[model samples]
Target: MKQKIRDILAKHGGLPTPVDQLADDADLYAAGLSSFASVQVMLGIEDAFDVEFPDNRKSFQSIDAITKAVSGLVGSTEAAE
Candidate 1:
């Protein structure tokens, strides 16, 4: 899961460093994520996870927020199974 998130961020975020090296709680905006990049990140995450993000996803403010939301999404999926 973490690897997938990292790959998405790297693929869409255009970060200078590897995505894993980044702190999950780090401010992505401060870390170099542009507004457009955030949208691409969202799309990447949705595709990678095969999860359709609702409008709520737009509220996430940082990598940690995204991580937590995605984790919960996976957890719910697993629980539902």
Candidate 2:
């Protein structure tokens, strides 16, 4: 899941720094993730995971946060499966 998120970020993050070079807790915005790019990343994640992020949940600051969010969504989806 972490690698999947990294792949999405690598494609959409628009960060000046390489996604692979970032630590899990690194602040993406600080690394040059623009707001528009973040949205693209969010959409990519949703498409990859087959899950929708809640409008109220605004937590995509770092790789770890995204991993946690995807884990929760995937866990529930798997339970339903």
Candidate 3:
């Protein structure tokens, strides 16, 4: 899961530093993640994980936040299935 997040960030983070080198708690916005890129990342994550993001902006703050949010959505979706 972390690897997938890293891959998504690597593809869309727009950071000067590589996404794989970033810590999970790193401030992605501070590391140059733009709003548009984050939206793209969110769409990628939703497609990859087969989950829908709720209408919450804070869900994409950092890699850790996104991981937790995705885990929750995946968990609930699996439970429902």
Candidate 4:
């Protein structure tokens, strides 16, 4: 799931730094993740995982946060499966 999220970020995050270089808890916005890019990333994640993020859940600040959110939506650890 982490790798999947990283792939999505790499494709759509628009960050100057590589996604792998950023820690799971790193602040993506500080790492150059733009709002527009975040939306793209979110869309990519949703498409990849076939899960929709709830309208009230807006915590995509880092890889760890995203992993948790995806895991919650997926309801298991096999999210990448």
**Candidate 3: where is the Cα deviation over 4 Å?**
76-81
Model 2 lDDT tens row, 8-72: 99999988899999999998888998888888998999999898888523558899888888878
RMSD of each: 3.2, 3.2, 3.3, 1.8
Q: Cα deviation in Å at residue 44, candidate 2?
A: 0.3
Question: What's the best-to-worst order under lDDT?
Answer: 4, 2, 3, 1
lDDT accuracy of residue 6 in candidate 4: 96
Model 2 TM-score, all chains together: 0.87
Model 3 lDDT, full chain set: 0.83
Q: Give candidate 3's TM-score.
A: 0.87
What is the number of residue pairs that collide in model 3? 0
Choose the strongest candidate by TM-score. Answer: 4
Name the regions of candidate 2 deviating beyond 4 angstroms.
Answer: 56-58, 76-81
Clashes of 4: 0
Identify the superior model by TM-score, candidate 1 or candidate 2: 2
Alpha-carbon lDDT, every model? 0.73, 0.85, 0.83, 0.87
Clashing pairs in 4: none
Superior by lDDT: candidate 2 or candidate 3 = 2
